[model samples]
Target: SQQGEEDPQALSIQEGENATMNCSYKTSINNLQWYRQNSGRGLVHLILIRSNEREKHSGRLRVTLDTSKKSSSLLITASRAADTASYFCAPRDEKLTFGTGTRLTIIP
Candidate 1:
């Protein structure tokens, strides 16, 4: 399977502003998972929206998947300093494909 990559590679925004990141894949997937890794912490599972689902939300986070476009997007509302982390998306399969991820900086 081909690895999907995150768009914008990096983003910076004020603490209270919303942040959005896009991920695009090369092949079909069963499900797509989103993750966040703080400076020194392990990747934290954020959202796992399936191929049949269009949107899912967890707290201030929203995930939208458009299988037709073979793409997904992650939106973080009411961002905070703690939101400063690298976000990654992976496809659920026997061989998982996860890209480098998008680095987000929240300026206080």
Candidate 2:
């Protein structure tokens, strides 16, 4: 599988706080994307940053990619209970492989 591995199988944060998660892949990739899954639902694309890019931000989401280290990090600022969900990072390919994911919980 081309899927990368992510740390912190679960995370609990309070509302208005921040959450961070990391991911590491084995092979090189063109781009990496962060997705959020609510309970037993489909994944929602949060952000995507190419290998040529170091960092990208969207609203409360900030993502950083390091090709040399084959790793990436996602940061969510001022998190809310509505943001509670599992986050998975995957490579941008025809067959996208997903990691186990980080189960995030935001306390209200």
Clashes of each: 0, 0
Looking at candidate 1, the ten consecutive residues that score lowest on lDDT are 91-100
Per-residue lDDT of candidate 2, residues 50-105 (tens digit): 98999999999999999999999999999988999999999766569998999999
Tally clashes: model 1.
Answer: 0
Model 1 regions lying over 4 Å from their true place: none
Runs with alpha carbons beyond 4 Å of true place in candidate 2: none
lDDT of 1 at 57: 95
